[model samples]
Target: MKKLKIGIIGCGSIAKHRHMPEYHASSGAVIAAVCDINEERANVFAGLYGAEVYTDYRELLANKDIDAVSVCTPNYLHAPISAAALNAGKHVLCEKPMATSMEEAKDMIEAASKNGKKLMIAHNQRFVPSHKKAKELIAEGEAGKIYSFRTVFGHGGPEGWSADGKESWFFKKNQAFIGAMGDLGVHKTDLLRYLLGEEFTEVGAFVETSAKIDADVDDTAVCVLKTESGVIGTLAASWSYVSKEDNSTIIYGEKAILRLEDDPVHSLIVQYANDDTVKYELGGIQTNEEGGQKNSGVIDHFLESILNEQEPAIPGSEGMKSLQVILAALEASETKQIVRIN
Candidate 1:
């Protein structure tokens, strides 16, 4: 079997910690090229992988030997870069919140369709062991009609995790677009949609830049979401979590209450109304913290999809659905009204 040649387009924290490492570990893929505006950073990764280095993404996209590319660039560049790569006949694995706007997301999807190449959004929450098990239990009717949920993903701002530290583009509105809502909220929205197999139809939110005094983007967001099936829930994303990162979800159902990533030892716990308890000691979700370096399973999945000529698990359309919810939430926050999704 021919190994897929991958070109990484960003040398940021995500690219360094997730894409590069995972691609290097994969038997079906090899890093054939790397690109970053910062040639020094790109060179570092290039040397590690023995891949070509380019300051311009277009030049990397022009490489005929590259089968696919991972768009790990800032949020603002996702759509254009992915579109360009797709048009260049390379499959794309883009980071989530796939685009800054619905129009951009639509354009990305159209590019993938027009090029006949797979366009996958790196929404890796679905691949977490605990999350996957939770989805299975919910699908098996063990939860028995989820009534409400509260999912939160909070960390101490991207300044510490980003490659450029305090000078990272994550703090700029023009670069990151919507801050925590895009950085963390979209992941939960995607997870909710995947776990419950339902679409969020309405959203009400409060998005603010309560912390990070120098930042232009929002640092905190809280949203109330209504699914098409009428399941209501709250979602919170924040860069203001000072003490420790909190990535947890609690789902209340008729038969049981499901707690995810709430305990240090157990990744998931289900407590039934009948006084029975089930705990899953599934491994931790990947994080930026030390020793939290679990494989995200995204690169492997993308390679498999391309090799098998099948649609990706999280296609551009699915990414748009999740992005639509976040975009609607942003509007709701600004207008102080519940925005309905079309």
Candidate 2:
């Protein structure tokens, strides 16, 4: 099989940790080009992969040999870059919050549709071992008729994980847009939708900037979301966990309560109504901590979809659906009213 030539835009932390390494390791794909506003960073990655380097993403996109690209830029650039790559006759694997606005997301989807190319969002939570196992358990009736859930994804902040500590685009409203809500909230939103097989119908939230006072974006958010099936849940995303990270989700069901990523030894645990408990040591969820570079299975999945001409697991449409929930949460916080997802 001929390897797909992949160009990487924005050679930052995500591109370094997830996209570049995974693509470089894959036999089905090759990192043929690298782009970043910083020429030095682009040169470093390009040298490692023995690929072309471009300081401007547009010039990289213009390359005819590149078959696809991973848009690893800030949240605001996701849509425009992905759309441009799609229109350039290249498939796109964009980092999530896919876009900062619904209109932008729609445009990206439209571009992919018009260009007959794939557009996959890198919502790595869906690829987590515990999340995958929980989805299977719920589908198999282990967690019967789930009624509610409380999912949280909180960390100290992006200062350490970002390439530019304390000065990354993550703190800028123009670049990051919604901060933790967009960065961390959207992951859980997409994960819940994937696990429940339903879209969120309503949202009430309190999105604020209680931490990182100097930043112009929200550092904390707590949303009450109601699914189409009338199941309700609380979703919280925060960058104020000054000590440790809390990436956990607990689902309450009729037959049992399923806990995911809440325990150190066990990744998942099901406590049945009959007082019986079952634990599964699936694996640890990915984090920004040291030694957290687990294979996300996202780049491989993207390559498989393009190579086999199959629909991507999380297409632009799917990403838009998840983005809608976060958008509604933002609206709810602004208006102080429960916003309905249409």
Candidate 3:
């Protein structure tokens, strides 16, 4: 079996815990090389994955053997790195919040088009079996006409999840450009959009830096979205949850109400219009820092898109759509008004 020659652009926890392990576990890929600005860390990751290492991503892209790369860097670098790789003739798997701006996101899509290579975002929630089930039920009309939803992804903050803790690049506006909205909020943004198969048409948001004492970025974000189908919902993404919850989503419709979460048991539940309740205490598709689950199932599906020439479950355009929703929410939060998504 031929394996895709893959490189990873960042050696951070997402790489160490998600991408590298998934690539190693997949029969479709091989870790051909890894690049990080920190050479020591890059080399360490490369050694563990049996790949070469480079400090400069430019040098890594120069490799002829590498056919694809996962852009696991900070938000600002997503476009440049992914574009460079695509132009250099490699498929790209970018992490979420596609870019800081829609322009950047379009550039990624265009580059992939210009090169005829695939570009996908790692919105792993799509692969969670519970999520998949929810999508199925919603699509099948078992949930009836969806009316509303509330989704949240919160944790104690970047101090625990990032490479530099509170000092992590996530809080810096230049590197991350936004705070909880970008880091934590964007995932649910993508999930809600995907599960419903609808675009968020308007947004109203409130964002705060209520915790993380000295951080310049927001530690919590709450946004309300109006979907094209007349669905109204709230999405909250935060880093100040006091470890109170993992990521979860609830949807209410004419026929039933649905809930899904990442937990040891009771990962998903539903109560029908007739008050028939069912619970699915299931496992996640992939593992996280807490060893809960992974987004790698999302990663593997993207790899199949590459290897088989099928469409990515979540492509660059879909990622851009998700980002646009979040960006509008950010703007709404700043202005204290509803912002239209055009």
Candidate 4:
């Protein structure tokens, strides 16, 4: 099969650390072009990868040789760039918090459907080894029927991950839409939904801009979420975890409690009501602080989906569903009431 030529838009930290490197390392794909508003950053990645560079993403999208594009830009640009790429006869791998609004997300899904192009959201948490294992265990009834869960994704701040530090688009309300809620919360939303095999039906949240100075968006958010099957849980996303990060989840079940990424030594642990404990050292969960030692399976899956003409695991519709949870949480925070997911 011919290698899928990939164009990377927005040469920021995620592009540099995750998308570009992973695509370059994948034998099924090739780095065909890179684009960023910062011409120097684009040139640097292009030089390292030996690909063409562009300051404007539209120009990169116009390149007919590029079979796919990674939309690694700010949250606000995700929908527009991904829709444009799909319409331009290119498959899209868009970064998460799919879009700022449901309207935009719907438009992206519509564009991908109309263009008959695969649109995969880069919710890399689903590709984590420990997460995959947990999902399997749950499916196998290792934890019995899940009753509740508390999942959190928190870190010092996007300052550590963004190329521009504190002044990155992450802190700007217009660019980021919602700070940690969109940045970290949506990841957990996707993961929890994947693990439980259910969709969120309602949300109640307290979103605040308490930590980062002068930030217009919320830096901390605690949401109460209810799944379609009546499972209740808390989802917390924050940039205020200064000393250390907590990317962990504890799922309560009828037979056992499954702990994921809660221990330094064990990536997953199961404690049963019979006083038995089983620990599994699958692999460390990827984090903004420690990153990942290996390339995330996202690029490989995306390439395989395109090459085989199959729907991606986290397609545009799946992304939209996850985005709705966060959007409902945001609305709940603003309205001071539980918001129903539609």
The better candidate by TM-score, 2 or 4, is: 2
TM-score list, all predictions: 0.99, 0.99, 0.96, 0.98
Q: How far is candidate 1 from the true structure (C-alpha RMSD, Å)?
A: 0.8
Best of the two (1, 4) by TM-score: 1
What lDDT is obtained when candidate 4 is compared to the true structure? 0.92
| List of clashing residue pairs for candidate 4 | none
Candidate 2 per-residue lDDT, tens place, 1-342, comes to 899999999999999988988998899999999999999999999899999999988999999999999999998899999999999999999999999888999999999999999999999999899999999999999888999999999999999899998999999999998899999999999999998989999999999999899999999999999998999999999999998799999999999999999999899999999999999999789888853578889999999999999999999999999999999999999999999999
| TM-score (C-alpha, index-matched) for candidate 3 | 0.96
- What total of clashing residue pairs does each candidate reach? 0, 0, 5, 0
TM-score for predicted model 1 compared with the true structure: 0.99
* Per-residue error (Å), model 4, residue 289: 2.6
Worst 10 residues of 3 by lDDT: 284-293
Error of 1 at 274 (Å): 0.8
Error of 3 at 118 (Å): 0.4
Q: After superposition, how far is residue 333 of candidate 1 from its true place, in Å?
A: 0.5
Cα lDDT tens digits for candidate 4, 116-225 = 99999999889888889889989999889889999999989989889999789999988998899999999999999999999889899999999987899999999999
lDDT of 3 at 258: 90
